[model samples]
Target: MTLGMVALVGVGVALSARRSGREASSATRLGLAVVSVLALWLGATALLASTDVLSFRSARPSPWPLLPLSGIAALLLLGRAPLAKTLLANTPRHWPIVAQSFRIGVELIIFAWHQDGRAPNQITFEGRNFDILVGLTAPLVAWLVATNRVTPKPVLLWNVLGLAILANTVATVATSTPGPLHLDWPGAPFTAITTWPVLWLPALLVPLAVFLHVMSLRQTLTVPR
Candidate 1:
């Protein structure tokens, strides 16, 4: 389900970049961007999972490779804007300062919930809430910006919110356990809301949601330098 969402996001990115002012330039760059990021992520995920120091969780380390890779890919995409200046042309994705600031805001929000009392190592209601928040915010913000309903000025906010959601989800998975036990019809609030699945929502759904949001952000929004 999540992989499907990630693929959908890829389509969104392709479509959105095509409409940008630097269409021709973005074409080559976007290809390199996606392909390069994928290669890096998969390659790294395989190598690092066996390492002892960087080990994330004891249960399922499969997604361990994805966390850092995704984080770095996003960080690169946000940071390396200047390199893509020619590709951006009128629709500049330039938001270096804004992106950094947004990332900080998102991180603070993630950590804030921890300040009161940390949830268990298993699935967290707090973490799922963040993913849903980004899922709602990213697409809407993308639509608003693309339609000129809002300024391209808040690109940083959108990206920050999006990536922060991803980062924090990964953080939770790394620290929490899968809680080997399962309950039946527990009348959990999350079950009523349909946000909580059996296992932690972190690895199962959040990655795909994060990618979907990014893709939606690209497809629904068009900006210029």
Candidate 2:
């Protein structure tokens, strides 16, 4: 799932670079540079997780919160960069909508983790997390946009709802997990997320999903509807 998230980011970066009006070679280099940086970042995150740097006893404040916070900060900064602006201006508006389908896999993994007893039911589809709905509707929304059956207004609304739901899911897990913000809940704690591999769910996957939705909103809002 970690590698898949990285690959998805690379795809978005490559597509954006290609459509940024740069020459093919320059675009390819730009894409590679952005993707390489993200790959390296993920590698470091994974290493930290392996060393138990991201995890701690359930009674203590987990270092895991820092990972998602840092990732979100980086993404926000990146979104303000010239490259991101160019990408928003050039990339097809529907691309981000389509890209959101990746969340299906994310929810699936969470569901499986819950079943495996690694995660809590409160963070799964059967629980408070309804993020799977956004993923399931992504294809339909993209198709509506493609067929001109919906305007940018509707797309923007969809993005807003998606972002809100994602934020809810993040909140659900953060509170349910063993951390500074931990909230008491029934069943097992969501300690699996602080471990290696699974840590990427918050560090990479959630942040990437956020970026996609925010970028899609930017693109849709600026369209000459």
Q: What TM-scores do the predictions have?
A: 0.43, 0.93
lDDT of 1 at 70: 59
Residue 162 alpha-carbon offset, candidate 2, angstroms = 0.8
Count backbone clashes in candidate 2.
0
Q: Candidate 2: what lDDT?
A: 0.83
List candidate 2 stretches off by more than 4 Å.
58-60
**Model 1 agreement with the true structure over 1-225: per-residue lDDT tens digits:** 333333443443454467654466666567556655645554454454345433323554333434545554674475347634332342323212112223233334334434534333123434343544553454456555555676644764666566775676555444443232223312221111111212213322344344444533453355453
User: Each candidate's lDDT (Cα)?
Assistant: 0.42, 0.83
Best by TM-score: 2
Q: Which window of ten consecutive residues has the lowest lDDT sum in model 1?
A: 189-198
